[model samples]
Target: MNNDTDTARLRKLDQDHHLHPFTNLSRHSQQGGRIISRAEHIYIYDSDGNKMLDGMSGLWCCNLGYSQTLIKDAIYAQLQALPYYNNFFQCANEPAVELARALVEITPAQFSHVFFTNSGSEANDTNIRLVHRYYNLLGKPKKTLIISRKNAYHGSTIAATSLGGMGAMRKQTQGLDYVHHINQPYWFAEGADELPDEYGIRVARELEQKIDELGEDRVAAFIAEPVQGAGGVIVPPQSYWPEIKRICNERDILLIMDEVICGFGRTGNWFGSQSYNLEPDLMTFAKAVTNGYIPLGGVMVGDRVAEVLLSHSGEFAHGMTYSGHPAACAAGIATLSVLRERNIIKSAADDIAPYFQQRLQTLKDHPIVGEVRGIGMLGAVELVRDKHSRERLAPDAAGAVYCRDRANATGLMVRQSGDTMITAPPLICNHSEIDSLVNMLSKTLDQTAEHFNIR
Candidate 1:
């Protein structure tokens, strides 16, 4: 089709047929939409030919970045060989096996088995079901509740959402009764004056207290993101993860780390579990598994958990049609190959990420910057009206939107969650690209401060 025809058709089809996820449809209809024609390296080209830097790395995935030929070739080759397969009924594909093996090689040593799904949500949903069922099969049916930290983003599926602590996500839905929440180990908002270890331990104690209140028998597992991603990149205090690990071990409750955002080298380590030193029994992973090229996610179960699962009868009783899709699996293989062969993790975490953070820290001097937090390639600049008091910028004063617009106008594609501008550039970013990213963001910060009339 011609460009004009394609654009018109897409606009019409989108307006009529497409219901975008996590969006207000009615409002979107009025505004039409931004059409991204293509992406190259760290830059996305809109239909209007404007280039924008992808600061959020396309929802915190895209580690290998856009238009990598290796991933394309893998999918093509897989289609030529075996395009699809069913993992059901004792059948599995080569790519699935290879992908699972690849994950095992890189993931924490504790995770020995991998279960596939189509997305992070499904993976987490599977985690909830599998963990709960494992306990039930062990004759502890009363152990059901999955304790999650407040402001954590697990996933959007009912069970996964139930584990998440975002107030907005929990608002309208009738949350699952089996899930419970505890205070996040966010020292910034919760205990600004306290030492990191002290605040972390204090917040970690809440888990024990909640277990007592809910009755230990009722709690089967505790789930969390190593770093709170969607809830504004809230990194925990130093003492938190260690204490959490100890508590879970002492109580015999399985620990589930939702690594959907922080997995696959977004953090300095291969997984957020490693970054935080979390020894989890079950974990959900996606987003970066295939660099978002194809939808693929899975739960990595520890040997103990897997052993318990295998002992039970009747197939574990859950799966999606797209589970272990050959093409997606092929893409995953290629993505991992690129990650390991190129040593992207070390490059991002040890070299590039440190540079990213060093440049990002410059913004902390700005009056609007309350706190700058992140690890490796992922980072966030939090805007505030009063830094000392931790006063948030008024919502929709166009604070975040204004900054995003200014960045895009200057050929940068930064995303904002609340008042924080999040950045997770592709792992392939070079030093020059890194400098450009920081310069563009710095300029946008200046513009935002000027727009708000802040000193």
Candidate 2:
């Protein structure tokens, strides 16, 4: 990292060969980004020797931060012991079996079984197959349409992308025809003139309307994140989930909660569905399940769905080669151990998360900060020129891009989602670390305000 020659060589190599996910390829090749050298605790160092506080928690994973040696050691031990094995042909590894049991224990009472995959995208893809197979077993083959919310992120595979309602992602992926979308509970941007609770109810009923329009008999399931994470950390109103739960109960439809970002203590509970008090028929989880140390994801299939799937005597006819990779499962087991034994979820919920929210709330008075909304450890600050009217500072979300760049230059790793500055800091962050993050963000706000003439 310290060597200029090696740094230049590495940069060139990356610019030439690496095809980064969710990045502008032409821009990256022309102007390469920082090459991260190493990390410890909540900080990452680049080859240029700049140290950055990882405000996004390694893309909303690494909840325990970079120094969780227990997870690393578990992966090493598992690899040394079993090396490689596929959960196929009546085969299963010890870690995979143990991890499945642990997931059932931590998740809600309904989730008695799990179906593993390599990432959340694949897990959601699995959900489609599981739903179809379950309904087909029940003699309801007409149930094929799935309902999601606008601007919500599920994943990026063709089916997952179809499940996701992001127009940008769907534009390129050619989403499935059976998938449908409804309104998101993004009060600040979409809740014009109405109170949040009112908006929540109105939007929640959209599910019922869609089901009726598409014919209730054809509707298969409803999938959504507890909070819209990648579409911007847009938390639903207090009334949203209750209404959603009611609709699902009254109608013959399934519910799938995409907890890829809100799982593993991010939302003050083992899972975000617990925080919101909703029992999803299926729950998709990844990211923090392995503490981002390794790729591991799955669906926590509820008893309602599991019973049908188990009762039928036939191959599911769907599975990944590394459906339950031993090493990844080992990492997940260790991650869950850290969460349960230390009570990290409740601890952070009681102290650090509240302090983090309070610190972020201080930015509300800034010239460019229009709104500050957060829950547990995730938050977003929407930027605007005139707070009352909610006028954007620039077109095409250029203002948020500028603010994120300023944040990075000031040694704080963060991101711009739409027109908001989004953050999902590590749950292990203390009061002092929260202050440092806020101070850096405050400074970035000042720079951004001046840059855009936003007095």
Candidate 3:
């Protein structure tokens, strides 16, 4: 994949047959895409040997970066020992059991058990099943309605897609009727006229309003990410989560925190729930669980839900073939071991993340940068034509799209989500690597400003 001949052959095949997710199929077929051949540390190399800092951490995974030999060796060893196995019909793999226990130990005190799945999408889908069953057992079968927020991205499965509040995705599928949405806590994009704290409280109360509108008895759970990751790192104001916590507690709605992007120290704390100081009945996790080395995701079943689940069980009647595949579990165990031994999460929070946020914060003064918002290593920069009024650089997010292209061409890998440029660099990045990423992004911003005539 590194050489021209192989790259060209691969590109043709990919364009001809590969239908990529979240892409314009016809455009991809016509223009093709970059062939990422290899990676090291926080950088990725294309087929042409163009090295770009992985500012998005390989789609917000790869928290420990590409050089975790521990994870690789674990996967290899697991393959040699177990090769493959299914956790079905009274069968349980050693690695799977060990990983489950390890997860319980690290997560919040409420999380005492886990249900494994191959990806976050599946795990979120499982949330629906578990929530429904929990209520069914409690004899409240009507309490199946779930409330989410607009632009919240749960995952891609039909159930997860409906659970997510992204309109573009929901329109493509016949989503579940049980899931409903309220507005997101994106103050800059939606509530600029109001003070941030005021907007936060107002938006937080929308959850209460939504529950009331739908009848509190019918609404079983309210699901949300601690920070809106795929929705452009929309960091809620300081007042948001506390108010949200109040609503869930008072309304008797089970809180489901989608920590797929914010878990395992992406949010400076071990999990977003801890960072926000909220307790969830269930938590969705994946990606960094294995440091993106293998496919493994699961729900951290908090005691609130687990107790009911355990009290009554007659073959839960829901599971995947690869629910607890041993190799993936080995990868997860090794990843957890690396985090514990090195204390990567805490160190990143105290040092790397602060520096990363500081460097990106400098871009707030740029001519076209409307705002810079982030916590831990994840961040977003909104591109604007008029920073005062918060007018976008171009209609339909063309400016950020152009800026993203410039960044990739100039050796930095960042993402464009609507009018905002978003990044979640690996937690393993040192000061120098963080500097490289920010410097590349800074240059990209200058080019974007010049191109857009934003002076």
Clashing pairs in 2: none
Superposed Cα deviation of residue 122, candidate 3 (Å): 0.3
Give the per-residue lDDT digits (tens) of candidate 3, residues 168-227.
998899999999999999999999999999999999999999999999889999999999
Candidate 3 Cα deviation (angstroms), residue 97: 0.4
Which pairs clash (backbone N, Cα, C closer than 3 Å) in model 1? Answer: 53-412, 53-413
Prediction-by-prediction clash tally = 2, 0, 0
Evaluation by TM-score, superior candidate among 1 and 2: 2
TM-scores across all candidates?
0.96, 0.99, 0.99
Using lDDT, rank the candidates from best to worst: 2, 3, 1
Q: Residue 411 in model 3: shift from native, Å?
A: 0.7
lDDT of 3 at 317: 93
Q: Candidate 3 has which clashing residue pairs, if any?
A: none
Ranking according to TM-score, highest score first: 2, 3, 1
Quote model 1's TM-score. 0.96
Q: Cα deviation in Å at residue 22, candidate 2?
A: 0.7
| Per-residue lDDT over 279-349 for candidate 1, one digit per residue giving the tens place of the 0 to 100 score | 88888899989998889999998987899888867668899888999999999999999989988898778
Off by over 4 Å in 3: none
